[model samples]
Target: MKPEFENIPLIKNEEKKRFEIQYNGHFAFIDCKEMSRQIALIHTEAEPELSGTGAAAAVVEKTLMYIENSGKKLLPFCPYVFAFIKKHPEWKRIVDEKFEGYNQL
Candidate 1:
């Protein structure tokens, strides 16, 4: 399910409760909960075919951009999202620094 990273649109499927990127006819997504003006990234998963292709990382990056650009705060509840923010600390600006476990990130 690996696909070209560029030009791919991230979809915030509110009814589905996830941010999604289509790949190889499948969907790679970040399961999320929107609450209190925050997007709580609960889990990240890609089709097994996309594994190791870094596709999930791209989805996470796009999701972060959506959160930041939309002025929505982040609650990186998923370990992958947390690690992504930890690595790119600049994205931390979209996170509520006061959140529990934010310091661990």
Candidate 2:
């Protein structure tokens, strides 16, 4: 079996409108919003120092986990999330591929 994502400390920055994972003062984030039964992912970002560290991958996993557990489907608008899906095809079940802008990718 693939290794399950570890639970990293995260802050739900409601005011900032994103879930953030901070490390050594730098951070990675997944910006999302709920729309009825869907959770639209607005974007994903990671500090340059944390890039390629799997921090963003963990953020994407946790974001999808939160949406799935909340009984919502996903509209993965973020390019990072789409790339994450390409690497983790098992997550495809929760993706709403019919979303407009995502089709162009």
Candidate 2 achieves a global lDDT of 0.77
Residues 11-99, candidate 2: write the lDDT tens digits: 77889889787765789899888778898888999999986777787777878878777788888878888888777777777877677
Clashes of each: 0, 0
* Alpha-carbon TM-score of each model against the true structure: 0.91, 0.80
True lDDT of residue 18, candidate 1? 94
Q: Residue 6 of candidate 1: its Cα lDDT?
A: 68
- Per-residue lDDT of model 1, residues 7-104, tens digit only: 88999897989999987787789999988688899999999998777789989999999898888899998999999889988888889877798788
- Candidate 1 error regions (>4 Å): 1-3
The RMSD (Cα, Å) of candidate 1 is 2.3
The models' CA-based lDDT, in order, is 0.87, 0.77
For candidate 1, the lDDT comes to 0.87
